[model samples]
Target chain A: SAVISQKPSRDICQRGTSLTIQCQVDSQVTMMFWYRQQPGQSLTLIATANQGSEATYESGFVIDKFPISRPNLTFSTLTVSNMSPEDSSIYLCSFSGDGKQDTQYFGPGTRLTVL
Target chain B: AQTVTQSQPEMSVQEAETVTLSCTYDTSESDYYLFWYKQPPSRQMILVIRQEAYKQQNATENRFSVNFQKAAKSFSLKISDSQLGDAAMYFCAYRSRRGSNYKLTFGKGTLLTVNP
Candidate 1:
């Protein structure tokens, strides 16, 4: 399993402000996924980030609001734009192991609190 | 659309005792994967066990095991000899085995409390 790390474990931001979270995996991976977990709720797939290509966002997610960047195989960034209180959630990044083992490991997660 | 359901919102067990977390999912696909992930206070999702839909045998890891009934669409996790460390939010996830669809559908989660 690749060791995953996310920057700014948590943050408190004001409404209308934007925050970018960084996810870095110890090893190179082909596919990286971003998920958002609202307080006391389950995880929802925000988008899929693949290196050298634009991300694929879910139905409710948009590139303009939740932009993703996959500069390399091991690193990706997710930025929440024009954030509101409803955007407060824990964001996680995960990747499957070479897409063979049928498993996905996740990062520690970035907890964002919008006021 | 695949949907995973965790009926119990919370569960408790005494140390060294046993506990079971229930999960059910609806999917038309025959070949898929089911997983149990634990998210502790630190919010790190840890894979506890996994069951391939094609396999009849249940999946187990240490004291954590799953009773998978494909016909009933039920995948329940049984934790024997439960420890305080086992306390966390358990989420049931479903993934398709077919083509580039590797995204997971997760349940709301059940918060487990292990009391010593």
Candidate 2:
């Protein structure tokens, strides 16, 4: 399993401001993904951060709202833009190694609160 | 599209006893992967066990085990010797077996409480 860490473990921001969460992995990985979990709700995929190319956003999410950066295999960042109270949730970053479809590890998750 | 379902919203067990969290999924593909992830009160999710559809034998990890029924499309997690640490939210997840870009579809989750 890869050791993953997310900066700004918990944060409170103004409704109109933006906050960027950083995800760092101890080792290089092939696949990295972002997920959002609303309070008391199941997790939903936000996007897939691809190295070099643009991040693949999920249906309900758009690049304008949630921008991602994957400059390398071991690092990625997700920024919540134009934040709203609705964006208050836990954001998680996960990754899977090469040829390891059955194993994906999750980060500790960043808790965001917009007021 | 694949969908994972965890029917039990909540469950309870006595310390040293056993508990099973029910999970079912909707998928037409034969080859895939099923996983059980545990999230404690602290909300750090971790993989408990995983089962490959192509494998007939069920997967087990120490006290955690999975009953994967391919035909029935059922995957349940059985935790033996339940401990206080086992009290957490358990989520069932599914991923496609064929694709390189495999995104996980997760169930709502089942919260388990261990009574001392």
Candidate 3:
């Protein structure tokens, strides 16, 4: 199991403003992922952040709205761009040990409230 | 695409009693993994149990255990000697072992309440 820490545990922002959430892992990992959990809803995959490359966005999500950055294996960030009321949700960062392991360890999650 | 389903939206169990949460997944691939995660009021996600598809034996961690039925594509979590601390939202997840993509498909989740 890996220890994942996310910054700015909770934040409140204006509707038009954007917020970037950071995720840091205690140890280096190969793959990192981002997910969104709306109020009273299940989690949905947002994208896969690859080190030194563009993030892979899932269906129904666009890179323009959710830009991701992964400069190294142990760290990644997800920026919620052009936020709206609908963008209010809990953002989580997850990672796996390697290809051999299938379970993911999740961060504490960043709670964003868009007003 | 792989998908996980948790039919029970809500469940209640008395303290010290046992409870079972049902989960089923759909995947064409033979090799995969299933997981159960718990999210309490604090909102922190905690891994409860995990099962490997290739392994025939069920996985158990103290009071938490899994009933992995590979042939039936069913994986249920059994919480024995439930306590107030066990009250939380439980999510069933699936991951494809063969793909380079390290994404997990999560179920809708089941809210578990334990009453003393």
Highest DockQ: which candidate? 1
Q: Provide the TM-score for each candidate, comma-separated.
A: 0.98, 0.98, 0.96
Query: Candidate 2 on B1-116: residue-level lDDT in tens?
Result: 88899989999999999999999999999899999999997788898998999999999999999888899999999999999999999999998888675688999999999999
True contacts kept of each: 0.93, 0.79, 0.79
Candidate 2 off by > 4 Å? A98-101
lDDT, candidate 1, B14-111, per-residue tens: 99999999999999999999999999999999999999999999998999999999999999999999999999999999999999888999999999
Judge the docking of candidate 1 as incorrect, acceptable, medium or high. Answer: high
| lDDT score, candidate 3 | 0.92
Worst 10 residues of 3 chain A by lDDT: A96-105
Q: What is the C-alpha lDDT of each candidate?
A: 0.95, 0.93, 0.92
Interface RMSD of 1: 0.5
Among these predicted structures, which one has the highest lDDT? 1
For model 3, residues A8-110, the per-residue Cα lDDT tens digits are 8999999988899999998888889999999999999999888988899999999888989999999999999988999999999988774434678889999
Worst 10 residues of 1 chain B by lDDT: B95-104
Worst 10 residues of 3 chain B by lDDT: B95-104
Instruction: Provide the RMSD of all predictions against the true structure, rounded to 1 decimal.
Output: 0.9, 1.0, 1.4
